[model samples]
Target: MRYVFFNHQGRAVLGVRTADGVKVLGEETLESLLERGVDLVTYGANAQGPSVEIGEQDYLPLMRKPGKIICVGLNYADHTKESPYAQPDYPTLFPRFNSSLTAHNKPLVRPKVSDTLDYEGEMAVILKSGGRHIPKDQALEHVAGYALFNEGSVRDYQFKSPQWTVGKNFDDTGAFGPDLVTADELPAGGKGLLLETRVNGKIVQSANTQDMLFDVATVISTLSEAVTLQAGDVIVSGTPAGVGFGMNPKVYLKPGDVVEVSIEGIGKLVNPVIDEA
Candidate 1:
């Protein structure tokens, strides 16, 4: 089942996509529901509540307060080639705070500090439970759902130091939802799906999930060996080549630009770019 968080009557509520419309689960957030072990599929099927036409409500990040937002860089071979760093045997991981997350249709702020705001379209995996040292073979079992992400970056800040945290975690830079498709709704480890990014309706990046150098399972398993993965923690499976930074002449987002990231089976996450106030 597809799940989302949206604003209903001025309050944030969890919702499940229904044949009629979006069924309001409750005022509880997605993270709360998962933490309580609520059976989303069952609740969505049997619970009776108000429903709203999808386009009429305000969208929220799929999980408003994910415990952690772990991102993998250079997970796609082509992206690694385009980047300045040499390809490594291990996954290149980083963290994004919740402060950076904005919902679908929201504005991605291009900070005044730099005009190098760029887009990296990606697929993100949300964990259903917590574990440590999880075996790579069994990693798929830990995924709760999948969603799309626009890893909007402030390029100038990113390369100022070896650490990418500053550029990647700028408030309102990352766009992360529309809805979450349960693991069962997609292929194992979300493999074989087409992922693409478009700017102002023009395709800029295109690739398949199969092209990822470190697939979903490997990322989860590898991270688990060091940090304990928790329920509602999000893993942003890195983007493919053709990012604005990788393009010839180097295209970057400007005010009034619309960026859309779409993945097969999952849905599109569209956001507009605006100058930071």
Candidate 2:
């Protein structure tokens, strides 16, 4: 079932799409939905309060408190080519703390520290349960779902030094969601899925997930070997080319610019750029 976290009244609430409208699950989001009960049908009756239509308002990030937001870098060949970085034989990983996550339709703060902001369209995987050293064959069992993301980056902060932590963890740099499609529900694992980034309605970058150098399964299994991925952990499967930094004359985001990241079956995540408060 497609699940989304939206503002109900003034608070974030989890919702399950229904034939009638949306079944307002509760104030708690998807994480709580899994802990309370997977069968939303059981609570559908008590959830009878008028449901808010998602498109009518802004959405919060898919998960409010994912334990970790692990990111894979240069998984796409074109991305490596654009930046002219070495192709990785294995996934190049980094940590994007949970505090950096913002929801779909939210305003992303382009901090004053950097003017060279770039957008990386990507697919993010949310972990369903805990497991360390998980085999490739069984990795799918650990995935809870998938969401689209614009892995916003500050090039100066990221490339000024080898370590990417500082540039990658800027507040609200990672914006994703609309909903998380359960792993089993997505089409052909790691196959080409269209991904695109548009700035103010103009297409900037577009590519297919099939262009990925390292597939989804490989990323999950590789990471699992070292870390016990728990429920609510999110893994961003890198992004495609067409980034601002890759353009002829770097085109970074400025205030009032709108960025949209789209993945074939997962849906689109749109966020507007805003100056830091």
What is candidate 2's lDDT per residue for 29-117, written digit by digit as tens?
Answer: 66665544354334443566565577645588888887788999988888898985888798899999878888888978899888987
The local distance difference test score of each candidate is: 0.90, 0.81
Best by lDDT: 1
lDDT tens readout by residue for model 1, 1-277:
9988888887888888888888887888778777777666666677678878655238887877899999999999999988999998999999999999998999999998999999999999988886999998999988888999999999989999999999999999999888888888899999999999999999999999999999999999999999999888999999999988887888899999999999999989999999999
- Give model 1's TM-score versus the native structure: 0.97
Pairs with steric clashes in candidate 2 = 192-210
Worst 10 residues of 1 by lDDT: 48-57
Give candidate 2 misplaced runs (Cα > 4 Å). 34-50
